[model samples]
Target: MTGNGGGAGPARLGWLDALRGVAALVVVFDHSSATLLADFRRELMPEFNTSRFGIMVFFLVSGYIVPASLERRGCVRTFWIGRVFRVYPLWAVVVATVLGLGLCGVVEIRDFGGQSAVTVAVAHVTMLQELLGTPSLLLVLWTLSYEMAFYLLVVALFTVRLHRRSATIAVTLAVLAAASVAAGAALPASALSDRVGTGPLILVGASVMVVAICCASATSPVLRLFGGVLGALPALVLVPFNGTVPLWEGLVILAVMFLGTAVHRAEHGQGTWWRAAGTAVVVVGCAVGSAYRYGDGELFTRRGWIAAFLAAVLTFGAGLAWRRRQLPLPLTGLGTISYSVYLVHPVLLAVIDGTVGRARRDDPALEAAFFAVLLPLCVLTHRWVEVPGQAWGRRLASGPRRKPVGGPERPLLPFRRPCERTRRWYP
Candidate 1:
């Protein structure tokens, strides 16, 4: 997250860090449990769905901060640059490490379902592989696809001057999510990819994303508008039609994120709290209704999904409520390295799975040991990889920056380089 002003003071942001830290640990447990705490997971997941809880929290946090980051910058080019540097460096390092591990025979790489290397590489490079019908190389990367989609949508709104309508957008997505289920509009995963060949879809999607980003970053107003609209095309086409997740779920994900944005807007006085509260109500109700009507998925129960969703929303609300209080350093520190924890843990678990194999039974000691090892390693990754990349991004973004036409009010969007002032707040 960038910028320290716009009503997001240290107290407000610290709670977000605490939330990230909590979510990271939950997600780490959700993934690692299959190998280290199999029985416990089996017992817990059917009722709680720890994975869903963790990610929903993440999406909410992303919603809360991402739009703020863009609006605070007031420059789409610099915003994109900041996002690329913040996300890609750690991602590239982790992907390369995973591939290296696979090549070394330390872990088995997941099958790409017969996709070509070129196609896979292109898909992953765009960070929309999950929505493009290509499997994510790492299990955790699917969420990044949605994050990228939100970024595009945010840019689109900023360019078109609809950036402040987050509450309306959020409610619309939620209602659509509910309505889709009511209409019984069931679509297979990757339906678009199935109809249009994977290669063709990837080619078109990747090409459009490149053009969209480049044009959105351009100085010409017409080009920016065109690029903004074009950028949203891929996300609009892919999320509902091609994502690996169910249609309702994908829509819900986006809605949840926008709901977070609404919360941020309310906090900053850009919008009213009543509007934010109402959006949250609509979104949560629609999400819960959609899950209920859709019934259970292959891997999760309806009850479990609903429980996790509610828990995530409640967790975020709790953090928001306590936004002013000073949070514990250990929790905030974990939040600082939460991204590293999220990416790095999957690789470590994969190695353990391929090498020694999973624990035959519930092993609390082994689970404890895994965390003991993971935290320190994530800290190192954060220090070496994340910090330097963000520093470079700031340096680059500082050059040749100008505010977008009709962007947020300057007083409401003050500039404060986050990397220099506060600890990193990974979405």
Candidate 2:
């Protein structure tokens, strides 16, 4: 049943990947509306499917999976290495590429390209360009910073606990969230964020709430259902006039995730019907607001059904077969380099649209054609430069490894806590 390397792991959760992949594309699609479906997407669908929110879905998946990996891998180092590999190297390449282009004068030198060696080194190496207000060479790196912070938090917590304190340690973070609001701190909202989305304390609180909820979820179904409700409720907050929400809303996002993860854990029997429900919630809930804002206000009066259809299919449209471990190569490829793909695609849009789009202004057909070509090229970049860089990062962080039980000896993909074992962590 297993291959030489245990056939690249077991029935790989194609659904998670496929779902994540869809989430990414939906965000893209929603953004594309900025061009093609301009009015509809920016207004009606903005809340329905967003890149930031899609990323949160992956975080939910990660929150669920990381614990399992930790259980099998047996140490924090492996987890750290895996996370580093997954993030930095590819990022460095983008930073370098932007710099390389700046040197060549092929691209315009935005403020991010400064004249000093220290400036370049610190910005690129520390991944602090976003904080410096450099208009990130890669627009998506902001989220990477938050993700890195999340990783460091995980490592720090693990180190302090030494697997000794209860998982309950995550509880104290909630008070921090409340305090962030009180202190008026700037914490990045999601893993991919700018302006520190919320505040560190608030972020910590969200993480803690997430951890607490997940710990409870493993053994409780009711909490899971409650999570579903929490996740669904956020659709309401995405209003037509929500010009600015309090920083505290980020905590709400995390709170929804807490509920979402819980619900996902306790739920099963995935297929068409369930997918439809989720899609409806996201599409109707989010897209309606988007279309109402950006669209010509003809959504219900004109393209109402089309907006609804796209939202449903895009949001909750699940293909259970995609969840199988033996994922299709495209999906697998995307999953493998998703981080890179996410980072590169935004820049790719700016570049491709700048080049191809300038020539085809007032021609939506041309923009679509260029987008089609760009998507594959985008994926290839992920496969080559970014993927390899991430691999290098992991190798640096990694100490070496042991095999996952019943699996061939292979590099662990970081932590995913398991349910069966309580004290098997150090072994």
Candidate 3:
């Protein structure tokens, strides 16, 4: 959650960490059970949709923290730099490892459906392959597309001095989601690719992303503003027409994120609690309404969707209610390493599926074994890879060294200075 260089004390959000840990474990269970306990998965998925439940929690947390991260630093360039270091290092490693394993015939890679290697590569690098008519190398990477879009939109609002209007933005997007359903606007997935073609779109998107990040990070106000808009517009445009999910769901995702921001505002005394509460109601109503009207898809059941959505909201609310209380050490520790848990589990699962194949029957013991192996690996990766990468990012974003007048330069810490009461959370 690094957004620019700043002094931030260690995060005090034990409840949030606990919530994240819960969500990460649930997501792991959802995926692992599908492979190791298919009969149980078939029974549960039709009722609960655990994957959706886990991800919605993640989205809400991201919404609550990401904007605050950017505003606290008050520097777009450093924010982008921090994000790059925070996300890309491990992403690069994971992708390379997966690719090497595929090459070594330890696992199979996903086919790109006739797209050129260069186009697919560029799209994945931009982290928008999901929206750009390219398949995700890893299924979970699809969520990162929306996360990246949220980042662009958040920066756009911040640069324009409209970041404080979270409630309005949330309400507006929710209304639009409902309206899209009502109007029967049925756009096919990857509509942008259908028009511009996948190869060209990937090339253009990659170039624009490069320019946008560079310009937004520049010192010049004009460049920064231009870059911000350039970055946000694609997400704004594509979500309606090119997203894999329905247009309404895409809008709901944005709305849900802004709702989280509104809650953050209310908690911080920058906005009234009533306003946040009202916005939440409107967003929830609109999301459920949209789903009802759109009907269920092959992968999504309306009952499951509604249940998961409400459950996620309730879980987040519960966390907020108990935000000040101490949480279990194990829960907080899992939260500390949740990102590694999220990213690494899929790779391990893939390897498991490749080597041993999925269990034909329900195997709770096998599921437990998977967690036993995955948790320790996540701890190691978080300690050695994520921590060091974030530390390096802090040093780079801290800018040019200013020699002390009399004393030696102090050593840099891996953590940022705490912004008042603000704490870091990840997507």
Candidate 4:
């Protein structure tokens, strides 16, 4: 979730920023604990599942803001342009750094399990490598696959005039998720890869994604609609079959995201509070039910999953309650650089794991030291990398808007009655 800040608009939502900051730290802890606090992590993971908790909060924030961004811009081309610039520059830099490290033997990269470099590169370029059965260079990038899927779905709903039905969409996805669990598994892991072959699926999915984004951003309405649907079809096909996660949980992820959108709609007077509340209940219930039915996986406990899911919902609700109030600058500042924090910490952790190795026992001091180094680096990256990239996006999007006589030039995305409550918060 990001906006063109060069467009004069409403005050930023500090609460969302605070939430992102909190989630980023939690995610950092979730990963760092493995190396620095292994014993404590073992004790806590089966009960809390910190990773799920952190990611769900992020998905909620993304749900709350992303559609509003598209609606604000009212031009698919500019929206796509904003998204590419917001995400890719830092991502490219990070990937290059990882490759460089791998080359120089500073850190080892993940084995792609027989995937050709060309196929892996194509899948990663689409950012759907996780779904297409290509291993992520950075393990955290699996979540981005889903985030990209969500973006396509959001654009599809928007183009079809169904964006306002967030509550209904949330409930429907939840119900489908519950049903998937009840019906038993439809496919094994990487089902699409098994059927179509991983390399071919990667090529096809990547091609579709590129075409969809380009066509959706086109000026023609028919192309836009076709592109939106084209983008959505891979997600619809992959989540229930080829996903790395269980079918039900993958669906639940989408449901939770729509649930966040419903909350945003309620906040902005586009929908009633009751609708949002009801959607939350249904989505949460279905998610819990699915977890119970699916039982525990090899790596995660059902109890942990259920607890984390519930806690994430409660945490989001708490944030929404305080949305109108000012948040502390430290928290908001952390949120402002949360994206860098999320992406960079893993690279740092990889370097640490490779060089220093894990502690023989739980070491809180080492974890603290990791953060002390990581946060300042994130601040620097956010300032130099993200800010400049986004500014370039704004300039690209705002190409030559007309000025009125003796007045300021209009924004590229003309202002509709803005929804102050729906300010974009990047993941």
Q: Encode model 4's per-residue lDDT on 1-427: one tens digit a residue.
A: 2322223232457778888888899999999999999999999988999999999999998888877777766666777778888988888889999999999999999999988889989899888888998889998899888888988998887766778888898899899999987888656779889888998898788889889988877656688789988988988888777899888888999988889889888987899999898899999989998898888333254888889889999998999888778778898888888889989999999999888898999988999999999999999989999999998987887776443445543344322322222221111
The digit string of per-residue lDDT tens for model 1 on 1-427 reads 2112123565667888899999999999999999989998988977998999999999999999988887766677777888888888999999999999999999999999999999999999999999999999999999999999999999898878888899999999999999999999989999999998999999999999999999988766688789999999998989999989899999999999999999999998989999999999999999999999898333355888899999999999999998888899899778878889989999999899889999999999999999999999989989999889888988887765344446542333233222211111111
Worst 10 residues of 4 by lDDT: 418-427
Summed backbone clashes in each candidate are: 0, 41, 7, 0
lDDT of 1: 0.87
- Best lDDT among the predictions, by candidate number: 1
Query: Which residue pairs in candidate 1 collide?
Result: none
Which residue runs does candidate 4 get wrong by more than 4 Å? 1-12, 296-300, 402-427
Cα deviation of 3, candidate 1, in Å: 12
* Model 2 Cα shift for residue 217 (angstroms): 29
lDDT tens digits, residues 1-427, model 3? 2121234433556776777888899899999998999998889887898998998888888888888788777667667777878887777888998999999988889989999888888999998889898989988888888888888999887777788899999999999999988999878888889998999888887888889889877766688788888988778876777899889999999899899899989998889999999999999999988888887333355877888988999999998998877778998789878888888899998998889898989988999999999999999988888888988988788766454444553343322222221122111
Which portions of model 3 show Cα errors greater than 4 Å? 1-8, 296-300, 401-427
> Relative to the unseen true structure, what is the C-alpha lDDT of residue 168 in candidate 4, on a scale of 0 to 100?
93
Weakest lDDT window of 10 consecutive positions for candidate 2: 1-10
- TM-score winner, 2 or 3: 3
Model 1 stretches with alpha carbons more than 4 Å out? 1-9, 296-300, 400-427
Every model's TM-score? 0.92, 0.56, 0.91, 0.92
Which candidate do you rate higher for TM-score, 1 or 2? 1
Worst 10-residue stretch by lDDT in candidate 3?
A: 418-427
